[model samples]
Target: MNINSWNFKKDILILQKELFDSIAPQTAENRTVANSLLLFLKYSAKCLFLKWLCQTVENLK
Candidate 1:
């Protein structure tokens, strides 16, 4: 909820972009594979976060 939290997330995104740019090949080939991998990783992280959030809320109840 804090402004700093938003800024920190933004910074993390920027760093992620930089990492992707560095790892992905410049050629057209394999680009989709790289994107798919990143997408899978993102979704996996979201699922883990949601699980954690649910556990936290239940604990607080």
Candidate 2:
């Protein structure tokens, strides 16, 4: 995939980190939240992409 595209894994990771943020009440808490955020982003990203594709196809002639 093109580097400029949102579908790139690197871009996803970067965005995930940015979205997750590092500020937390403790180190372990930050780590746990980070892991959960990563999983959430991965699943949500795939699901959203699939939904978008399905909708686009449904709109086709």
Candidate 3:
């Protein structure tokens, strides 16, 4: 709910959008590679967000 948390979420969203945009225009030959890279980014982002959420919750206690 705070400014820092808001900024963190915004940054994550921007990074995700940029990643998706970068991979969206690849050739068919590179589709497999792009798919894997996108999957990796998605999982990494989820992990990062979860970690941040945990820390934020801990700070509130």
Question: Candidates' TM-scores?
Answer: 0.52, 0.51, 0.51
lDDT (10s digit) by residue, model 3, range 1-61: 9999999999999999999888777655488888999999999999999999999999999
Ranking by lDDT: 3, 1, 2
lDDT of 2 by residue, 1-61 (tens): 5656746787789877876666434677879999999999999999999999999999994
Which model scores highest in TM-score?
A: 1
lDDT of 1: 0.91
Superposition TM-score, candidate 1 onto the true structure: 0.52
Task: Decide which is better by lDDT, 1 or 3.
Answer: 3
Off by over 4 Å in 3: 1-29
Per-candidate Cα lDDT values, in order, are 0.91, 0.84, 0.93
Compose the digit string of candidate 1's lDDT tens values, residues 1-61. 8999999999999999998887766544578778999999999999999999999999999
Backbone clashes, each candidate: 0, 0, 0
lDDT of 2 at 25: 40
Q: Which TM-score value belongs to model 3?
A: 0.51
